[model samples]
Every structure is written in structure tokens, then in C-alpha cells.
Target: MDNSNMWIKHKNNRSIKEQVDILVKLTETHKKCIGLPKSKREVEFLKILYPASIRNLEIGDKFIGKTDYSAVGFGCVTSTSGVGYFFHKHKIDELKNNTKDKELLEKINLVEKYWCDKDTQENFRKELKKSNPEFFKKFAKNDNYSCVVCGFSRLSGMQLNYNKLLDLGVNGLKKSILSRNKDGKNDFYRASLEALDLFLDIANHFEIETRKLAQSLIGDKLEREEVLKVSNCLKEIKKGEKPKSFREAIQLTWLYGVVAGVVNYGRMDDYLGEYLLDDLNNDKLTEKEALDLVKSFWKMIAWRKTVMNGRVTIGGKGRRNEKAADKFAMIAMEATRINKDLEPQLTLRIYENQNKKLLEKGLEVISEGCTFPMIYNDEVNIPSVASAMNVSLKEAEDYVPFGCGEIILCGKSVGTPNVLINTLKALEVTLRNGYDRVNDVSLGYNTGKIEDFDTFDKLLEAYKTQLKIHIEELAKAQRLSYDVMKENCSFIYVSLLIDDCIEKGKELLSGGARHLGGTLEVYGNINSANSLTAIKKIVFEDEKINLKQLVHILDRNFNGFEEIRNELLNAPKYGNDEAEGDLMASKLHEYVCMCIKESAKDIGLDSFLAVVINNHSNTIWGRTTLASADGRKKGQFMANGNNPYNGTDINGPTAMLNSLTKLKTDIHAGSVQNMKFSRSMFKNHINIINQLLEVYFENGGSQLMITVVDPKELEKAYNNPTNYRNLIVRVGGFSARFVELDRQVQKEVMERTLYE
Candidate 1:
């Protein structure tokens, strides 16, 4: 029978198990057609599958029926018209039903059979090759040669070229082995093996596709030159010697990382050991060599070549020891310093123990205006990570920044793919009855007429009603975006480096990426800060000004009212540890989080909130907001995401965290709190680190980031640009040299109070 006829026949007469069996056979045929290897991780993942009998399934209900299960989680069954039903695991459920025995067994068998098929491995390789070619080429080259760092090289002595290494064969391979034997118990060894295998497969595919595309786009002349350069480098490395120059070493290391990513499931930590500080300090390698390696690796990946979103973490929590400004960090910092190009954006984390010198070095790079590496703080962040994962201080300290500064406990836990909500936007919609007063879009269906609001209480009530409507609409938009991302974008490079994907036979974007669920980051809640502050002064205290007058003042950019603008500024603001401003911020945060929860519940997905005001939100969301009562002018920037307007918080960072703690973190999604400290703050207040950690976990902080700089230095640098060229500050999630950031971002940073 024809292929179409056979597929139709298989679809109709077969049970789910039978259909899976046929599919498995087809997969093997496809694998042979593609010439791919069988992956053990995929085989093991398939063995855990079981069919669940779900009846009368609603849109958001838990997937419950009689089924044998090993993992602790709730599974939901979903079906599109053309696609068959699939079960997605959610929460943990212990109760088991008996009546659906046959259906449960069939489901389990199908899952197992589908995972075990060799075709799955082949399909994964095909997707990786299709998506990322640079990664693949680097991997193939590394596998064909010895260690790129300490291997034989043509540039070495005349006796140590490719011919010599080939002649030595097993001896050369033995000499290249870096790890000592540990009776198969070495975690690093096992991880390396897994990473190596994965890298080879993914990299091979990536290279093939990349070369093809380059040839097609740039023509064969340029493609051949590129290929020859890479080929020559590999030939030199095969002799068990190191590259003669720093640039070649950099290329080799970069290739190694790209390959390691494929094998280790896009995990940076798994490959960190292969290229850490200790390796350089021990005289085994040089800082220039390591830096070159990372630079070359990134250059080859050409992040901009593919349209996929990319994230890079340069500094992590525990990794920030006293000498945090060590050679390794410097290498990563410098690579970013010189290469300000946009691909592979970098994130840098700041901690109490961080080396002052290293911080300055990163600042030097940022002052060049590249907006990287993004800075995160460990003093406040460690406890925040602990709270989110329910772990200990030490365990949380081990957290690493992943997927755009989201904290993930390295090799232990996942906390990404969380839902995001814009709380500030919610308030705006609520206040305007679904009409964005700033944009004048009729987003809400006139839930409450503006004319009916006779009192402040009535206005607030109308705002709350409008907030609920916008929250519902925003959640729907998020789900649609998630669906589109999952279906259209395949994380082939990430799949190789990250864990669980290969084992589960799923791609990273397809619910296989480490962290599941949604996190909403509320923007402009601080706009409510201005609004509430205005209401208290105009409507309640003075009674000389009314809502209408206040609105007009704001609309006119507070023109001809310098006295009123000063009065509004003096009105209580959020993040000052004062009851009036703090309470309003807290109430707004809680109310918005609740709206997100209610709307997200309709889709059977767990929702959380994170207040990430990284960078000056000026570039993305801030460009659109109107002048807020917080003394901001119309078409001017609003407060950074979830952060108070610049220069608004009069109190110190401690007060800021205290005010932030007023919100109910347990009830909402997740939040990102960014605080900046001058280098002087650490001079006599080293103990402040402990205090910061204490209040963060005690007050239910989710994510905390800190930037360390000298306020005097920044001021001088700003005033005399040439004098302080090396000054740097953490802008949002990345660090840039103080002079490097855009004028507005620089102004925002300068406006932040520098504690003594």
C-alpha cells in the first residue's frame, strides 16, 4: 500500500498502543534514512511512560484516572482537532483510581514505546542540525581531534604535528586525558561523557547546516575559506599540543563549549569545569587563552544568525568568592568588553565577597555602552533563591543565572518558564475602565462609566473592576504566545546542553526546558505609587486639588505648576519603608497578583509573579508610558519594571527591601528586586551582607540583584567622561561601563541614592 494509505489504515484500526508501535517502526526507518545514533537518555525516558484514562476532561482540570505512575505530579490531557490527546504533568497527586485499568496500561505502554524508539534520536539530531550549524561544525572538529586546550598542534614543535599524533594514536589520546580515574564514581567524568556524546551529535548537525547556509548566502568562496580555517585549526590540535597563539586557543575553547552545550543539554555549569579559573591558576592555561576560547566559541555560534532568543550567564552566586575578580571572571568580562556586538548577551552577578577589582573591570566594559554583562547581586539574591526553592542558604548560594537572569540551582532544580504579568498595565486599565488612558485604546468594554465615579472610593472600585478584565485578557495573550513559541521554535542547541529533554524525547520549548509554569513580571505598579500619592494629597489631605485637576496637571506634564510638582514629589512614595507608600505598593502588588492567579487558573497552568526591572525599562515598555504623577513628564520614561521611579526612594536599600517585603510573595507569582550599592557601602558595613540575607528570606523576597559602584566615582565619571572611563554600574540584569550606557539609563543610574 501507498504510504498515505498505510498511515490511514494504522490510524483507524489501532489502539493507542498499536498506533505507538507502528510509529516506533516508522521512526527506525527514518533514523536509518538520516544516519543518526541511538541515544541512551531517550531510551531511559521512554521506559517511564504510562497511559492515563482521563474522562470528561475540562480545560483546566487535573488529569486523573487509574494509571501506574512513578513521578509525583498531576497530569492534564489536552487535544487539538487534528492532533491526538497528550498528557502534560502538573501538580502531585497520590490517589489512584481502579476502574480505568486497561486505558491506563495502554497509555503507559504508548509513552514507553514512543520514548524508546531510535527514530526519536534521529529526529532530534535533524532538528538540531536544522536550527544551529555553527554549534555542529565546532563539535565535529573537536571530536575529530584531541583536546583543543592542551592537545598536539601543528604550530607546536615540528615533531608534534598531525602525522605524529596519528602515529602515536592511543598514547596521544592517553596523554590528552585530563581527569584522574575515580572508579566510575566521578560525577565530573560521567557528566563529561554524557556531555561529549551529546555535543558530538548536535554539533555535527549544526555544522552541516551552518556550512550549507553560509555557502548559499555568502557563496562558495567565503564558505570554503571559513571551512579551511576551521579544518586547519583542527589538524594542528590533533597532535596533542596547544594552539600557538591566543586567538586560535579562543576558537578551540569556544568550539568546545558549543559541543559541550549540545551534549550536556545547554547547561553552562556542566562545561564550567572544563574551563574554570583553577585551570588557569595552576599554570595549565593562561587567562588570555581562556578568554580567547569563550570569545571564539560565541563568535562561531553567531547568536544573531538564528532568530531564536539566547541567554548567557557570566557571573553566578557561589562562584562569587572573595577574589571574585579573578582571572576567569576577567576573561569572561574582557571578552564582552571588546566585543560589544549584540549576539550572546552576557549577565554578571554581584555579591558581597566579589573582588572590587573585577567589579571595576566589568564597569570599564559597560562604560563603553554595550549594556552587558548584566549584574545580579548575591547578598540579597542568595536568600531570594533559597526562598523560591525552599532550600538552605548554602544550597541556594549554589544558584546560577540562566535563561535571562532567572535563578536556577545548578544541577539540582529548575525555575524558568514561569508566567509573567504586567501589574502596572493592569492598574492603568483598571483605573480607566479598560481604556488605557495613556494610549486611549478601548481595551475594556466600558465596565464602569467615568461619569458615575462620584468619590475616591467609587473611582478605586471602578479601577479594580477594570483591572480584573485586563488581567483576564493578558493571561489569554500569554497562553497564545506560549503556544506559538512551543510549536514554531525548537531549541535544538539548548536541548543538547540542558537535562531531561533528551531523556523525555521533547525539545526545549515544547515543555522540556527545565522550569515549567509561568511567571508574570508586573510593570508600572509604581505608577500607581504616583497615582496613590497624588490621591492622598489632592483628594484627602488638602482637598484643594481634585482627581480631575490632578489628571489635567499630569496630562499637561505638570506645566506651570512647579509648586504642585514639588508637593506631589513630597507625597509618600513606595520603597521608603513608610507605611503610607509601602501599604499602597503592597496592596497594588497583591491585587494584581490575585488577578493573574484567577486568569491563569482557567488554563491549568501554575502562575507566579516576578518584578524584574532590569535595565532602564525605557527601551522596551517605558517608551510607551505617559507622564506619571511621580513627577515624570509625558512621553518620558516610567519607573523601571517593578522599580520605583529614579530618585523617588529617599531611604536606603534596607528600607527599599523592607517596603518590598510588604507584598505577599507566597500568594503571587515571582518578583525581581534590583538594588545598587556604592563600593563605599561595603567599607565598614561588611556585616550588611548578613543583614541583607536575613531580611530577604525573612521578608519573602523572590529574586534580588545588586550593583556595586562608588557614587563619587560615578558622578565624576558622568561630569568628566574622559577622567573616569573605567566606571561601571549594574544596569538591569547586565553590567555596562558607566559611560557606555544610553544617556537615559545613565541618568537613571546616577539618580539612584548612593548609601554612605
Candidate 2:
């Protein structure tokens, strides 16, 4: 798969030969680990990979951790973690194509041969086939139709505990990891210790290189000064001491996250705030200096290639030091205003009785056409998470949104959205009674034929049956994924930083974390709601056609049935403030959420819930999702998150807000609501925009990702993308520069109504 699409181009790929060197070192080190313990081997590979990594000390860049395209992230074993080893089949081919040296080509071939049958997927297959053949086939089939007909991937969506890391320091964590060791017999302890030691070696190697580079630069005083400062920061952090300044804190967090490939940095202000405040109160650094450090951190986040996963949350209730956090949050918002990049997906959690000036600063940032900080409402989310996760309200304060707005408890749970359920496709397959017309294969559970459904209730039951089966199997997959990861290797870095892992002397997936919960991503939510509503109105309630006739219309892709399609389209949709249609969505949404939560207990998980947090999967999956009662063309993008399908919510923004808030919030992990505003209204009516957000939050809205732009500008930008590289827009859960998106996704964005 071409990963260039999902991930942002965050780093400058080192020259091809240099990349080859890194891969060669990694493979050579990997070969040495053949007879060693799994934990030791993985850590040893990193120790070699680190010193060999290309060290860059660019004049303007402050942060030091940048690796070649060989792979990013901490784990070297699996693509789900970091796609390390840089020796995949395609990569080897590319390397062979580029390099003329027979030696290098042979070395690359050796690397490929080493991992050919020993990689994560291959190992997983051997294990699963031996232990669970039936499930392995099902998992493979799900993968074959991934991101389209609902599937799971090793792509983990989670956040590391920045506060814990900043507070504990390397020494503190080291002591904890070895605390329970008796004669070094514990395998977890030995591996964790080695991993930490090797991790610090990576830092130590860079520190020395940066120092050497700084010493050599005599004429460029500013460059040398900055380079020396970075070298010193690395030295201080590698000494096993907690960060004493804001720069140290941010630098440590960013570098560690880069190595670990752990995106979704949780509550930046909460962790790094006190350090900034200390700097301010003690006159160690001016506000401008601190702000510059933050801006540099933001830039580094964009430069690192996490794409869609670099989430940095700030602001909200239950903060340990609200004043300090607020101050840091304000600075962070200002940084966003200054550096309008797509990464570091800066998010602000808004609440009542909070800092007004901070919010005003956020508005200033947004008014500048920055697609962040995407505002999440704590008033709705806090209570919702407490109930959904069965935790206290105070514990709920730990709730932070991970990849594409899926809510997970920071450092406490591994809520990787492993399973995906396309609710719209659930309806589509139900209509086909188990057949997938687009793929020309019979997939999913057969809930009986259209002729068997005499009433709308029966039709609804069929949809429910199909959903129940898919979600249940996927839940098993979700749990089994962790089990598999645990079998192959211990996620040393992930376990070391997250909660209860060190304390429990176990890896996170191996029962080290406080909460071993999982999440299922639901896509095409509003489109599904609209389709079901249309079906009920046109087929059962209105009686304009029977179930068989409606299925026939859908089977024909609305051909020769344009009139019926129009009628179906005219039926009540979810985004309108209409109670009946909104209620239908609410009912179906509640059913799915509740069913998932129940499945968690049945499967022996601490907690599990559904999330309507969609990335581009709505658009990606919509291509294969057959046409339905929603009036969407067979391959048109599905309704984005819980937002209205494009141009279907004619009752205006207020009504749309009303319809959006109708879905029960407490039952699910999170649901994304995307809203667009015309540039005229957003700029001229800033107060009204503020009120709209406040009222929605106060009612029941959890999160709103707003994109304010002129539709004409979007069109112009789309037509001539090279000239408008700076144009950014919110695309579902993740925001991207307008010109960066594909033509179909661009069209979907253009098709959205820019409400006046």
C-alpha cells in the first residue's frame, strides 16, 4: 500500500544511499538478535539504528530528532507500530532501482530475506492459523476489503502520558522498571531496562553529534547558539533528570513521541504548563522566548510524519494547575496563529467558567483561517465519558481525543480503534440480504430477502442482525489483536510510559495498563441515518413502494427510477431539526453504541464502545458503498461523521446543531460533528459564531470541527492547487491543506454548502 496518502510528508528523506545505510545497520543488528531474547533483540536493533540515523542540525530547526523514511515510530516489528526495518518488498525494489552498487543491492536483498517470513504479519498468520484458523481467514477477508466493507488494522490510535514522563524523568521510570527485579529474572524488567538504556543512547549519540556540529560553526553565532542549546537540552534530558524548563519538557516529549511513533499527545498544557509558568515567574525566559519554543515544537510536529495522528490537547476542567495550563494554552493557541501547519492537530477542550481570554485567542487563531484548535466541549464530553467508561467524573477529566477524534482515557487505556463498522454498508448489505453488489461477492450475514421483510420494523431488525454479527466478530478481533501483539513482543516504550505498566510489571496489552479497553470506529453515520429514514418514509410509512421495489431501485443504482430516488431524497433527513427523522437516527445510533458497550462485558474487556470519529474512510469507503435511499450516487462520499450529508440540511445551521445534539452522547466514546461557515459570516459575525459554538456545547454537542472558507476560494484552489498550497480545510476528523487532498475528496469538500 502507498502510505504517502494517509501520512503527511513530515521529514526530509535523507539521500537514498544514507537510507540504505540505516536499513543495513538495522538488519545487521537484527541478525545478531537471532539467539537472543525477543525483548533484547528489539532494543539492540534500536541501539544500532539510533547512532546510524542521519543527524541534521539545520540553522533554523531547534528540535533534533529526525529519522530517515526507512520508518518512523518506536516499534521496529510491525507497520501498525512503526514499519521499522525499512526492508519491505516495495522498499527493496525501490532501493534496487535507485542504487547501482551490487553490494548494496545484495545487502537490501538480505534484509528482505531476513524478514520475509519473520515479520509481524507473517508471524501473526502462523500463530493465528495454528490457534484459530477460522478467525484467521475471517480476519484476512476483512483485510481484503479494508477501510471499505469494515475491517481492522494494526494502526494503533493512542496517546502517551506526557505528564507522567515529564514528572517521573528517566531515572524515576528506570527505578520503577527495575524495582521488582529479583536477580534480573523478570523478562519484562530486563527488556524494559535495555530498551530505556538504548533509547537514551540514541539521545546521547545525537547530543554528541550536535555538540560537534555546534563547535565547528564559528561564524554563524545564532546557529551555533541554537545548536549548543539543543545539545545541552539533550544532555540534560539524557542525564535521567526531569525537565527543569519548558524547552526541556517540550523537547523531550516531542523526541520521545517521534521515536515511539506515539501520536495523540494528551493535554499538553496540563503537563508542560507548570514548566512554562516556572520559566515566566522566575524570569528564566520571557513570554516571547517560551512562545518561540512552543512554535518550534509545533513546527517539529508538522515535520514528523504522523499525519492524522499528531493530536495535542489543551484547556478544560479538572486540570491540576488551571492557571498555568491556561497560560500555556493561550501561548499554544498563539503558536497555532503563527504557524499554520496541518500537524500537531491542536485541540482545545472548551467548558463553562473557563478562561474567556484564552477562547478569544483561539478565535483569533481560527479567524486567521487556521483549521485548529478543533474545539471539544467538556460540558457534554466529561459526563458522557464518565458514564460510558464507567469511571468517575474526575477520572473522566482524563478523557482526550486520539486519532480522528476517538475518545480514550489518557495513559490508562489502549483504545486503538481496531475494528471499523460501516453503518451505511450494514444497511446496504441488509437490503441485499448479504450480497455486496459492488464487490460482486456475497459478504456479511443474510438477514433474509426483501420479500421476507413485510414491515419497516422487520427491515430494521435485519440491519440490527448484520450489525450485531460484524461488531461481535470485530470485537473479538480487537481483543485478539492485543493478544497477538503481546505474543510477538513487549511494547517496551509504550508500556514504560503509560499508566500501571511499570507498577504492574507487565506490558500494556499484557495487563499492565489500568484499563484494557478498545474502540470500534463507525463510519457513514449520517448517510446511514438518512438512508434508513428515507427507507422508512418511502417504503413502509408512505407505502409508495414495497421493500422489494425499493431494493430493486437500489439494485439498479437508481437508474430508470430517478423519480423514486428524488422522492426518497425528499424524505426527512437527520440534519434538519425535524424530530421524527432525528429521532430515527438517535434510535439506531443508541442501539449500536449500547450493543458495543454490552459486547465489552461479554468479551471480558474492561470497557468497549463505539465512536463515530471518521477520517477519510467516509469518502474512501463510499466509493464501494452501493447507492441507497439517501439519494447519494453509488460512489458519492457518505455523510461526514454525524454531520448532515452535503446540502441536505436546509433548515439552517441552528437546526443542524439541534439535529446534531439529538444523538445521545453518553452512550458512545465520541461522535464528530463537522460544520462549515462562509468566510463572510465567520469574519463579520465572529460573535454569532462564538454564540453558535457556546449554545451547541451547552446543549449536548461534544465536538465541532469547523472549516471557514469561501466556496469560490475552494474551487479556485482545487482547480489550481499548486498556487494555493497554503489553503487548509477541515476534512472529516483530520484537517489538511486543500490542494493536498484527492480530486474526489476535494469535490466532496466543494460540494459542502458554505452556509451564509
Candidate 3:
């Protein structure tokens, strides 16, 4: 079919189900044609679509019908618009029963069966490659000769040495391949093939589409000019020469990703180390030069649309070569000082021996509000990861951030795509009989009338029942989306980078990746805190206010009730290690985890938990939620992602960790425990940092993100603002300048108890 005609057909579809079906089919066809399952990572990239696709198909309709069957089988026949109503699963059973098309039913069944089947992935890979040999060949040859950034030639008989490779073992080749493996195979040869295949597919798709998009958007002349610039950069790098300047290098790297189908391939620290070390040794690359290069690199990366989405990690404890990674981190921090852009998101790892200068630099960036370098505490994170996977310290150190802010052992694991459910939203739905103003929708299984409930426990039971209902629905949606993505979008490049794809002949998505599970971050648990506290104080404790009065006050944002607002604020809050607040946090986390776990089992996938209240916390979601009682004025900052509200946890970092330890990690999925330390704390008592981390992890800390900064400096910076422009803090997965963050977030960072 002509491209125009195909697009027209896609746009003209009438039924939402039909539109979804077409999307699924198009995805499957795309994978079958252009996809190659070279590695487990590649497969994972493919399998991640099932939940989203399923949800899209089931959106809006409360019951499944014949149209729903068509949607999942043939693809959606409508335009990709509307309220994402395509994701609702209200009528799944009805659709299954009503569908009379045997062929369509068979296709749906096949998709479902293959969602987690390794053998199916292997077959799909072979079939896809066989269908599009020419495309695959072109994709594979796109990058020839050598490493684009370092000019490390890949020519046969040419001996090459990279410190990164040596430190990572097998010249880093095995580690690179293993890192991409969606299925857990460590063999370099097999993993390489898989990784190569996945890389080629994704790269080719990206390259072709990007070229087409550029041409259409900018006209042929401009497109040609851009292409020429990229081509020149490629040629310059291939000549076994350094760029004339840092700007050239940055431009070259950006062009390389643009043309070569590799996005942000410069492990800057790894690639420029030789030059950096030489400069460091001879005092040739001054701090200014180092900083300029960092700035230049970010500018170039920001120029490219794709590179902006890429991530960079600076420090990892117990990495193949800890010393090298640490040194590289210092260089990266130096660079962050010069350039503070959002692209090339940088992460800094803090351990017992973190460089003080580097910490100051990071804080400087944070003080500027750029929020560039997010911090990770190796003391806590390393052990936490180790305990979760039961891997060696070295393996644990290899952990890297995946989607959102979850940690995965880079070279050795395949964690699930992020699946998020707002716990407070769920509670709201239950309270309103499946209607949520918070989310502006009705989503729940209407089991019965909840008005009959006479007690808080009965109300709680209804909420739990509702939670199970939506969770199960969502799990099914996740499975379907997984299948759709696996069949449509192939992860050729990812596969090549991950381990064991070629040997297993599986893609990353279909259980081939090391960690085979899904994680859901529960939001608005603090809302529950506010609600529970209000209920206890008003109905149970004070007896002066009833449930109606409390709800009325909440609806009013406590506008006329300054006294009540103060009371709620002074009341027990989560993260203070108070029994009332801590118990509520524990109950909410545990109950939510149970729902997710049970629902995940229904879909034949492992369900895990992660607490992500990062950037999303500050953003407005749904109409301003009524004023929360946790000292938060109405529309004030919700709990900082998963962490407690700013200044709420006053006891200390230890008390916060203790509250976290109450929940059983082994039983739940994974949780992120973020702690911010002042620079003064680091210098005065590094051992205290080490001991606290040990105690936290030993007592069941699941995941940790640590930020080191000086409170005095931070407060000073907040007041004066321009004195420290380079301050950085661990903001979720990546780092950012503290001063660049929204004021509320800045307050949150300042409020984190800096351990003494």
C-alpha cells in the first residue's frame, strides 16, 4: 500500500477497537518485516508493548464486545486521539464471548501465547530477518570500521586497547554484549549476534524515520545540509584524529548518533579518558577545558532530538574498575560545572570515599537549579542491589537506571517496564464508587453499593476490593501491551548491547531478559496519610468533627479552617518513625503490593513495587488535589515522589530508613529509598555515612539514591542564589542543578535530614 493510503486508512478508522487492532497488526507486521531478535534486550524492547496496547484496545468500553476482539486482532481502526480511552478494559469478557470471527480469535490467542514464550521470540526473530534481508543488511552496515567517538577501529588484525574493556573483562566486549542480553546468557559470541541484530533493527528504523521526518519538516535542502554535516563529522572521526576542538567532538558525536543509528554512543568518560588522563598528567586540559568539553557535549547532544532521551551514568561502586569510574565521575562533575543542560542526564554515585571537590561541584549545579547530576549512594545502593539479585558486588555495581528511575544490573538483567498506579487515586475511586475526580474518570469493578459501610474498616475493605479490581484489569492490559510492542517495535540495538540474545535466539521482552517482572510505583500514599490522619483526629480522637465535616473541609482546601489545617499538620506524619504514621505507610505500601502481586500473577508475570515520586510530584496531575493535611497547603507539593514531604521526617535519616525497613522487600517488588546528605556531613563523619548505609541495606533497604550536599551552603545559595551556580543533586534517575529545580522541590532537598 502507498504510505499516504495507509495513513489515510489508519486515520479513517471508525471504531476505537478497530483502530487499536490495526495498530497491533501494524506493530506485528513491522517487527516481522524489519525486526531481528539478536539479543534478549531486543526482545524486551519488543515485549514491552503488551500492557499499553491491551489497555489502548480496551479503553472507554466497560465491557468487551466483538469490536474489542477486532481491535486486538487486526489493529485499532481509529485515529490515535481522544482521552486514551482506548486503554480502558471495562468490557473484555463481553468482547471475548461475542466475537464470532474464528481467525481473529486465533490471532489474539497467538499473541497472548507468545507474550512470554522464549521459543516464540526465537521464531519471530528468524522470521522477521528472513522477511527483510536487504533492510537488515543495510542496517548492520550503517556503522562500520570503529568506535565513533574514540576512533577505535574495528578492522581485522588491528589491536585495540580500552581501559574500560580491560576493567570490565573480555576487553569489555563480553560485558557490552551481556549488558544487552534480555535473556540471561553470558556467552559473548551469541550475545553479540543478538545485540547486533536488535541494534540494527532499531537503528535502521530510527534513521529512516528521522530522515523522512527531517525531509518532510525542513524540506530537502535543509535535510541535505544536516546530513552533510553529520557525514563530515563521521569522516573526521574515521580519520583516526581528534576534533580540532571540544565543540567539534560534541558535534561529531551528535552527528554519529543521527547518521549511524546509534543514539548518544559516547560514554564520554570512557571515550575521552586517555586524552583526559594525559591532560590531567600534563596539566594540558585545565579545569576550564574539562568543564568546557562537558558543556560542549551537552549542547551538541541537546541539538539532536533523539540524543536528548539518552542517559549517562558517571559513578558506580564496585564497577569493573571502581577507580576509573570514580576518576571519570570527577571529570564529569567538572564538565557539569561548565554546561548545565537537561540532555545527557548525568548521575553521580556517592560512596564512603567520594571526592569532596566533586560533591561541591554537584551541589554547585544543584544550587543553580539545573538539577543535572543525580546522586546514588554506593554504600546503600550497592548492597541493596546485591541483596535483591543475590549477585556479586561487582555484578551489583553494574546496576544502571532503566525507565523512570528503577535500577537494573546493566549487563546482567532485564527488569520490567515501569507500571504506575496512584494508590491515592485508587482510594479515591473506591470512596466515590469507582469515580475519581483526582484522575477525572470512573475505573473500578462496581461490586456493590459502598454506602452500607458503617465503619472505617468496611470502607477500607471496599477500597481494597476496588484496588484488586483495577489492578487485575491493568495487569491484563499490560500483558496485551507487552505482546503488541514485542511484535511491532524491535530493539535491535538494545539486544546487541545486552547479553545472551543470540544464544537464546530470543528478544529482550519475552522473559529472555534477566529480571523477568513488572514494577508499579504507588503514588499518593501520603494522601492516604492525610486522609487517615484527618479521620482519626476528627472522628476517632477529637469527636468534634465527623467524617462529613472532614470531607467538607478537604473539599474546601481548609479555606476557613486554619485551626484544623494546623492540627492536621501537627498530627503524626509519615517518615517521622511515628507508629501511627509509619503504620499507615506500611499498611498502604503492603496492601498495594499485595494487589499488584496478585494481579500480576493472573497475567503470568512477576509484579514488583518501586517508589518513584521524583519530578512527577511537582507537576500538576488532575485538578489541584484538595489541600493535603501533611502541612501541605492545598495544591502544595505532594509527597516528593515516594519520599516523605519536605521537613516531615525530622527524627533523622536513620529514622526514615527504619520506617522503610518495616516493609518486607523480599515479599514486595522493589522500592527506591532516597537520602540527601549535606557536604558538611560527608566531611565531618564519612564513617557515619558508611555505618548508616550498612544498617539500612542489611535491614532490607531495596534501592537507594543518595545526594551529598552542604546544608549551610545550600541555605546560603538559596538566599544569595548566584554564589554556587554548579550545585547538583541526585534528582531521581539523573542529576540536576538544585537551583534549577522548582522552588518546592528545592525546599524538599533542603529539608532532607542531613545525617551528622
Residue-pair clashes, model 3? 119
- Model 1 lDDT, full chain set: 0.45
How much is 324 displaced in model 3, in angstroms? 2.8
Rank all candidate structures by their lDDT, best first, as comma-separated numbers: 2, 3, 1
Candidate 3 residue 287 C-alpha distance from true site, Å = 8.6
Candidate 3 residues 404-487, lDDT tens each? 355555544544433345555455445556653433444434544545555667767776776665555445544543554455
Candidate lDDT scores, in order, read 0.45, 0.77, 0.48
lDDT of 1 by residue, 1-756 (tens): 000110111112224344334434433443343432222322212222222111111112111111222221111111000011122121001111322456545544444454332222123334434554432332122111110000010000000011121223322323322234236453233333443434333334334433454355455575455554443444444333545433334333344332212111122322343335455656755766566566755554332221111345445455433242255566666777676544354555556555566556655655454455555556656765565444588866655554334445443333333223334444444445555564444433365654566576777677676556545544543454345334422323234333444344454445544433444445567766567666766665788666667666766777898787777777888878888887777777777766665665685443333434343443334444445666666555556545666787788777877777676654442345566665556444656754774566456554554556665667777778887676656555444567766677677777766666
Q: What lDDT, from 0 to 1, does candidate 3 have?
A: 0.48
In terms of TM-score, how similar is model 3 to the real structure? 0.59
Mind giving the per-residue lDDT tens digits that candidate 2 earns over 1-756?
A: 112335433343576667777777777777777688666776776676665553566668788766554532235223223432223465567777888998878877777777676555445446556765654554455443432333333536557887878888877788876667867887778888887777677778788888999999999898899999999988998887899988888878877776665656898899988999999999999999988988988887777656567788999997889999999999998898888998878889988889888778887788788889888888989999999999899889989997788888887877777677788887888888777776666666778897888888888898899888878877876776566666656667777777888888887777888888888888877788788888888888889988788878887899999899999889888888998779988888899898899999876788889988767777777887778788887888888888888998888899999998889999888788887787888889998998988888888888888888875999999888888999889987888888988899998888876777
Model 1, TM vs. native: 0.55
TM-score of structure candidate 2: 0.95
Candidate numbers sorted by TM-score from highest down = 2, 3, 1
Error of 2 at 181 (Å): 2.2
